[model samples]
Target: MSDTESRLGMPSGAGAWDERSERWLAEGAAGTAGRAGEAASGAEVPRAVPRRGAVDPVKALMHRHRELCERAVDPLEIAAGLEAHGVTDRTAARFRHRDVFSLAEEMFARVPRDGDSQGFPSASPSASASASVGREWGWALWALLPGALCAAAVAGLRLTEGQTRLLVAAAGVLAVGLGLRLALARGPLSRHGAPSAARPATGVWIGWLLGYAALGDGLLRTAATGGPDTLPTGAPDGPWPLATAPLLALALSCAPAAWSARLLAGRARRRLTSSRGLEEFASAVRPLLLGSFALYLGALAALLALCAAVLDEPAGYAPTLALGALLLLARLLTAHGFTHAPAVVLTACASGEAIALAGVFAGRLPGCGFLSVPAEELLDAWGAGSVPALICAAGALTLLIHAGRTLTRASAHAHPTPSP
Candidate 1:
């Protein structure tokens, strides 16, 4: 066996090392000898000499896939290409890597990024990601449409009365829904391929959360405080008791949510290209993730304040802000293909809200006042909005923790196969 093959533990055979690699290694050795002779002759060598007996196992693989690595935008793409060609985590071990991703990353790092040598203009990773994000900026603008529609509907609701108000509100909700669908259709939030089974369940839970916020919360509060056990139809002289602040805040938040998601995705792709290891990538991305989330929350808070001012409602309710944050985080996770956690968290939050309302009603039964006591105390201490706030805050916290772990992985951002 040749020295390089022996060091790499490859058995002597034609399959072990290709002729091209042998020639390349021979040329490299000759070049190294020439450099050493020049150094011996007192001519300065610009680069240090590699150790005499050292051999990089990945060098051959890197050389073999030079074109692939040079053209790749990120390590994930290289990993995907390697995977497509029958490379697995087990195969990666042959190159002294933990997995194909690690092997691909090493190869990507070794390859020169200069496109001039490859006879083509290559965009820098950051520039390419930014260009891609700029192309989709329309989604952010579209996101504003839903909020505008809802705000106009709220204005119409205030100006109308009785059946007319209800009609306006229903029409506003429909328009907002359709606008939201359009906004998410082509952005980072767009879902690819066959919808998962959990999608229907996610929609149902989302509907429940919104419905409860709009009406169930008020009814539950009224009943807990000893008001009549009845739904509030729109009073002719006043606006409907719908929680417009949360709805308005959430709707207005679509723009920031889309922007934040795009920002994070672009930054993450750039980080993937620059990060040297998985741990490095995670460390770098965690801060970007937190920053994007915080930016969204700040934007949501500003919108909530505006809504409260225009609607003449209290702006201090934690539930609305919590729900907005929860929804944004859930959407962000889902956008990145982490669907299960968001669905599970949303369901849990919805169930919690339902159970709280149910328990309050159950307490209304004779001798069952204990069930009502706890909920009533919470409402009395923090107001009725506290129920959804506490539940949604807990759910948001859970999703944030889950996202920190799952979204940091390289595989989460990779699209290895075409969606059917």
Candidate 2:
């Protein structure tokens, strides 16, 4: 018998049953035709009854989709496969089911839990489980590499001076970039099945946000102080007001982001498997989502505190923390396949920062004093960083609400592939 037949517990002579059913159907049709002709000819004939029991309606469907049902990891996969093949609730009713999900559940149950038939050799269950656990731990450690690289870079930046500082900074940036690439390649942040279109946009927005944090705030500070009419092309003559602390904090956050995402995805997958319906799944996964978010925030706060202490910067900056939270939430959403909302939120925050800068610059104009009042007052009260903090905090809150709704859905975690 073929692998499919063995896996599905079908007899080697199943084809004979198909032939017999076909013959019965053909004979039944012919009998009906004959009875119609006799009645039309005024010679009444008694109807013939079937000798065998009625064939199950779903049996044919199950045989036709045997491979799909057997290969599915869960009923959801079978349901998705069926829907992709144009099966709907109406189509499911023909097979005596209320919907495609119910039909898929029945099909999944009918298949025997034999060895893996997905063209791979099966291992002992305990061995496979142990290997999976090992890989998870390995990836978790790998995820910390980016943060370590960034921390090393921060230390190098603090130790160097003059032109040598520039070289060390350049090398540090390169090292951190490579570390980020390696860390995200196979860990929880790996981008296996993320939407292709949203990726470029996401990268653009992330760069904008980070770049603004590093240099844009200085420009706004310069403008607010009425120091220059033109934008700064090179380093300022005085002490570099670079807010590297926030940037470093964000970099160090990469590991926490990955861990939180893994925690949420792992727990959500378990919930998906155990829950009987959408409501149950949502209820079980919601707490996991909130807990993961809180865990990430706590980790980010610790990283921020560490960065601030090492760099001798203020640690109470709400904007820095808010930006970190916003970034983590955005990355989490994009990794899970909900990309549009994050992209949009990031864009809005970036625009708000840009507008704040523009308002500062415009306030220097002859008749646009009112345009800069808000920016100047905010700067005077809380410094230029407050602008980004407010903007990012709003964006983060928006994403938190959006995540609460989208991430709780079963469809959001449908594929559950790693993302970068």
Candidate 3:
């Protein structure tokens, strides 16, 4: 019998082989006389048979390869298969001259094109639909942005002097809104399995929100320092409202960013914990650098705006403005992409406060001596006005020092001392 038939215990003949086997079995049972007769007649003893089927060798190899790649099984069988096929002399030889996992990935990557023959789904219109929806949502966010600005402009016209009571009332409302958001955020987050990265992102987002709040708070403090008469002062007055309005809007916008950071940080932390120590530290540093760059750019924009308003020759300021703006935006985008660090948070806050100071100084400086009020009154106004600017400057300096320390520490880690 052939090797396959012998192994399977099956007759290697037509369907009539069953009858022949039965006859042989009968003949073999006839004892010594029959044994002598059988030897003369060239008869053979019979046995029960088993079923067999052809198993596709390639498909089995692919399945086993997948199992090994997924770490679901030992790779010994796969190695044996390769050796059996003479694909390599040694069972220890690498398959396809590549890591099993990498080979598996490549193999599966091409499977979709095989149209289900390789057990992969073909590309479909659903993917295109998702892409379309994402595009629409992105465009929609910016579509009504101008309308919101217009509304803020119209509202500013009515918020003139003697509206100090109204301004205080607005502050009260903002405080309440923020408080509600905080209270709501507390419940879910307290029980969350959120990751460490999320914490930093949360810190960064909170920092950004705080930065905007700091800007508005600084402006309010500056306005308050001017007394009731100093109302409607600063930055096209309309633009000031725009700036302030965006703070609330930005605070709300930060929610999504914070949540995203939390999810990402958690994933990153898990991945890093399993990795080499150096790689883990490098991963964390990426976000800090990114956040730092963003804060820098935003600060730069505010500075340029102040320069444009306050300087005599503003023509040459455009390039500086553009560069600063790009840098700030780049910083934000990069920080958001990577792991957020506390340093980036502090950096952003400091940059924002500095920009705000520039704005306040721009609006208040020249007018210091040119007020319609008496010279003595002008001196008093300068003294009062300087209070807010000084506070802002102090805050900016604090944040800058904090961020600087973090950056320095990070730098130190990146360049460890060598042992003699």
TM-score for candidate 2: 0.74
TM-score of 3: 0.29
Sorted on TM-score, highest at the top, how do the candidates line up? 2, 1, 3
**Total clashing pairs in model 3:** 7
What digit string (tens of lDDT, one per residue) describes model 1 on residues 1-420?
322222222223343225545665787778778888999999988875332212656776665555455555566777745654567678887777777777887777766543533344556999979976875666667778878887888788889877888799899888887787677665665543222223878878987998887776677767776765444675432223567777888888888887888788879878877765566777898999999999988888898898888788767557877887788888877766668889889999999888888888899799988887777888889888888889999999999999898777655555423211
Compose the digit string of candidate 2's lDDT tens values, residues 1-420: 443223223233345445655765577567678778999999968755432123555655665665555556678766645554567678887776666678778878765544545334667999989988997787777777877887887777678777887788789878977777676666676643222334676677777888787777777877777666554433434423566777788888888888888889888877766665555666888889889988988888898898788778766458777888898788777666567889899989988888888887777789988998888888899887788888999999999999888788765565531111
The local distance difference test score of each candidate is 0.72, 0.72, 0.36
Ranking by lDDT: 1, 2, 3
**Candidate 1 lDDT trough over 10 residues, lowest sum:** 2-11
TM-score of every candidate relative to the true structure? 0.72, 0.74, 0.29
Q: After superposition, how far is residue 179 of candidate 1 from its true place, in Å?
A: 1.3
Off by over 4 Å in 3: 1-134, 137-158, 163-337, 342-344, 347-420
Instruction: At residue 186, give the lDDT of candidate 2.
Output: 63
Best by TM-score: 2
